[model samples]
Target: MEEKKSNGLAIASLVLGILSIVIFIFLSFIGLSWIGLILGIVGIVLSVMAKKKNPTGMATAGLVLSIIGTVLCAMALIACIACVGALGQTAETTRDILTTIY
Candidate 1:
């Protein structure tokens, strides 16, 4: 009989990947994408380590999901920054216009 070993790292990676995506989707608007980005990065690391230890389907899935989540979080963060910049520019313009009118 052959014995099987459980891969806890792979499982943890998969769970973290899923959580990262979910968190990004649900809370990204309020500047919470950083949390997702961090989780995704950790998941990627764990998945890589798990793959080295036992190359399994779960590890591969975790890697893919983590990459996707990380990308999404990065995009969200960039968009948020751009929006804030635009808003600041607009506010300055509005203030200048009001001052000139006054």
Candidate 2:
């Protein structure tokens, strides 16, 4: 009798990929770009594993979503870093004011 392996990895990949996309969207709206970047990396790993294990349509979908999430996250991170750099170049008094606000 042939044995059937559980599709657990594929399912997990799908779920994580979807969650990554959702997180990316939410982060974009709230300006929490770092979280999105982390999630996107996780999603890409899961999706790639899923594809290697199962090669199903769902896995392909997950892969695509993960790639999109990664790109968006990267862009967000770059924008955030640029903003921080610009802020750093501002007056020393502005830094003191921000430190106090935080």
Candidate 1 structure, TM-score to reference: 0.70
lDDT of 2 by residue, 21-47 (tens): 777777677777667667667767876
Candidate 1 lDDT over 1-67, as tens digits, reads: 1112327888888988998899899999888999999999999998898888788999899989998
Please provide TM-scores, in order, for all candidate models, with all chains considered together.
0.70, 0.62
Q: For each candidate, C-alpha RMSD in Å?
A: 7.8, 5.5
Model 2 misplacement above 4 A: 1-6, 80-102
List the pairs of residues colliding in candidate 1.
none
lDDT, model 2, position 54: 65
* TM-score of candidate 2 relative to the true fold: 0.62
Candidate 1 off by > 4 Å: 1-6, 79-102
Assess each prediction's global lDDT (C-alpha) against the native.
0.83, 0.66
